[model samples]
Target: MSDTATRPEGRRVDRTSAPQQGSWTTARIVKLVAILAAVVVLLVLPLYVEEFWLRTGFAVFAAIIGALGLNLLVGTTGQLSLAHAFFLAVGAVTYTYVSGTSGGTANAYGGLEWPPLVGMVLGVLVSGLAGIIFSPIAARLRGIYLGIASLGLVFIGQHVLNTWTSVTGGFNGRLVPAFSLFGFSFGGTDSPELVIAGVPFGQTERLWYLGLALCVVACWFANNLVRSRPGRALQTLRDSEVAASVMGVDVRSYKARAFLVSSMYAGMAGVLYALSIGSVAPDSFGLALSVQFLAMIVLGGLGSVTGAILGATFVSSAPLVLQQYAGSLPFIVDPGQPGIVASQAAAFLYGGAIVLVVMFEPGGLAGLARRLRPTTRAPGAAIAADGADSSQHSTPAPADPSTGGDNR
Candidate 1:
């Protein structure tokens, strides 16, 4: 009897102590190496790329930031919004009107002449405030109804941009002040020219670095947000608002906060967009812009920050690149040519892609990328990693009272 008991305990101990094989160590090293390689490539790219590509890259960065913001709202919170362009317009106009000097076409508009950095900060804040003001409506409405209500905001904002002549320069638009920080202007240098690695670092190059830095920060912050507690709440809310409420999530508050965060991101993107275009016009913040933003999140894989960046890059750069190579490509032509315009071609491509993504792969690019990854794991590896055994994880059966606490 004693030997039998000892044998059973010995077997249990041996099973618990058995070493498990895993590929996690190798997988982690591979992931680290890949990240380093990508960072190095991005860092060195500017040294060799031409000015046009650099300019396009900056625009893509701005788009990426905007897309990330929209993903937070529509993808994460499950709220439909078409007023993103309105917020962008608010940011661009605020930045321009605040930083720009007093003088314009017919001297009709006025400006505060604040520092560019200050203007950028104020622009983001104003956009966020606008979002907060609209949050009440967002909280009340759901689904497509909310989408339509938000759409109305875009039309209202466009009208405001057109009629606010003194502030917005009416219909002609206003010039965007070049971004500068502490006397370092991100514009053409007139005296003691700036140079880097025997190459002149002009406005485009400077803006490229600025955009790159902001993009990195935005991506990092978004990833963190997605993985944190609030992110989980948002995801739960998206899955089922009633369930989220049962789980103690303040649905209304979270929804409102999501709007504020998303709009703030749009505001930042707007500032960058103004810099990229060198002007802000009423026509630029129409319904078309909002649709493009929606397409970015949809095509990139909803709720994925990295997907947002990828989608933005493709959407924002495709048209510019196509236009640049229109003559070399077939069927695509210049803006006024008989054939397809670059913008039209890009729209057709993304529109088709959106339909395919929705119909076939609801997860979008991110989900598709995950599907290509290997899912198999070493046996018992998960249990070992979790530091739990089957017995520990499950409820114990009741012991027989007559058998000294033993079931058998």
Candidate 2:
């Protein structure tokens, strides 16, 4: 039987919103298999990967979290912010003070020595509070103006971190207390001993898994948030604030919420960063860090969750990986050689990538992936996939011969 004949006359297919008739679509199966394969790979990676790679993976995970937060604010909400590093410093400093121990010859420093988990929670909360406090000013500015205003925050934060000797440990910075939960430490041998098929799990292996779990949770939450109602509202605001307000979206309120959520994510990232570096320094969170984050989202593609992850991996891992192989790579020079170092090399590479992506592929890696995916629609299917109403649609008339194929 013909499919068209089975349908009533004048009935539109509504292909954009209709459910798939097939039980096992090729796209669905591919997606399922890909996810399963990725999960399997992540599960066993710690067993085979070396410590250097494992540590690099942790750094990449931290960058992923930070990039995701920045993407939400800059890409999703259309806010150009350079103050992300300030919030990260806030979270890192808070975690250090809350979980650290008193030190120095004169006992000038102070710390509560609270549980690491409590410190992590407080880090997120304090970072969100900082965002909330800044939202009033953020709400008042837009575009380059807001970017300039946020730039000032980074300097102010740096000064505070440098001067706050008791809390921040002054310019030298403070050691980050090792994270532990329920008596199981993420560092040292206190982590439960385990032998899995002749492979002994150590601190590096344990931290790899920890980082994997957190990255998974961060990605999952970000994916869900971007597909929800609030995500749509933010996208609307990004495209046009006047239009969004006309559609009943509270512009200032939504902007504030976006900032709050983004900063909280940054807080989580900061905790991970502290753990990764084993210290929190005033110089660590600076304008350069903020620019690297911006580069991450830009390279990954704005408003694309997966692209952000890919970008973070590329940005975070490239320098460390390059430094590891600096002796072999032709153009890369060693740190003290005076030529372009691995970090600078990575910056140049991604900076060029940003320009190319902006010029040729604004969607970034995610857009490229979308273009590479196989099309699922059947041949001759007269259906739009963007939720357009077919009832009000019409086909264009045939071209006129006298107008030379142009519609006159």
Candidate 3:
């Protein structure tokens, strides 16, 4: 069968939702300006804020990283993995176990003491291992089956953490080592770096730079992958495996490679999360986190890297962002276990947010941006009904009677 079948109307199509091609050079410039503006805000934030804000900002950055990782798997590679928390946990627990005291903070020993960099490296590798080990599932399953199979990873990871006290520190969990960069033992826990001239920045501030740098790298990698021959193979696999095979694409190998690469990104994110939190609890990395990642891709819009970051930024901050309301509510300071009224209301609101996005903006933040700033279309030579410009080609057509055709 063909990659796609037409309905009553004839039109080329792919089952997946990817962006249609057209250079939005003008809009792209605006988008770049907006992105840089956001980065500038981040750079200047540490000077104006205390440690609390710095930590919160760092969390947002970490969440964005996680979301971006998940996006690589689901959004671009056409994989549906809801087990992202497994990688995050793998990173966190790996850092905790391999570091200093070698036990959970709640344990008598306190925790491990590997340098922060070492722990980060471990996290990345462990997370990637988790992904690599799960590669077989991606090779075999598709759509919902694949999603469910990957979802098992979260439960499996949780069970391992909760049961393996020797390594993961069981339920109580271990604290991450105080991050030491280049022999600077955190300088001062909160604000590691002091001002030399007119600049003031904290550890969290420094972390924002790291996080931004990593995210940029991830974006670039994903962009390159999608624009390369391998990316073309990936698209072919996504569009239709059988047809792709006919085109000499190794369908299984390509998908497996995609999964492996996607997992590497996830592993890196996990390491970043471990570094940011300095602790790893079995409860922190759970199915809920996986769901959150899934929701992020949906909210960001699949196949769009920039949109993934946007989704991750918002979703990761959702809890803290909702706390103002939690504090205002009667006897509901804790959102995780709020009063009956607040709990129900919060659940409804969360669901409502997802519903709103699916109903109105299927492409998520990217779609909204596109609407606000439509692409600049050139004159006369419009993209044909299928989004292809026909001006490049010439085809013979019979002349009409009014135009003195040969028949006439």
> After TM-score superposition, what is the CA distance of residue 2 in candidate 3 from its true location, in Å?
41
Per-residue lDDT of 405 in model 1: 98
List pairs with backbone clashes in candidate 3. Answer: 99-112, 99-113, 99-114, 100-112, 100-113, 100-114, 101-111, 101-112, 102-112, 176-278
Q: Name model 2 segments beyond 4 Å from true.
A: 1-25, 104-108, 189-192, 378-408
Model 1: colliding residue pairs: none
Candidate 3 lDDT score relative to the true structure: 0.71
Model 1 stretches astray by more than 4 angstroms: 1-29, 106-108, 189-192, 376-408
The models' CA-based lDDT, in order, is: 0.88, 0.87, 0.71
Candidate 1 global CA lDDT score: 0.88
Better of 1 and 3 by lDDT: 1
List TM-scores for all candidates, in order.
0.88, 0.88, 0.79
**Ten contiguous residues with the weakest lDDT in model 2:** 1-10
From the highest TM-score down, the ranking of the candidates is: 1, 2, 3
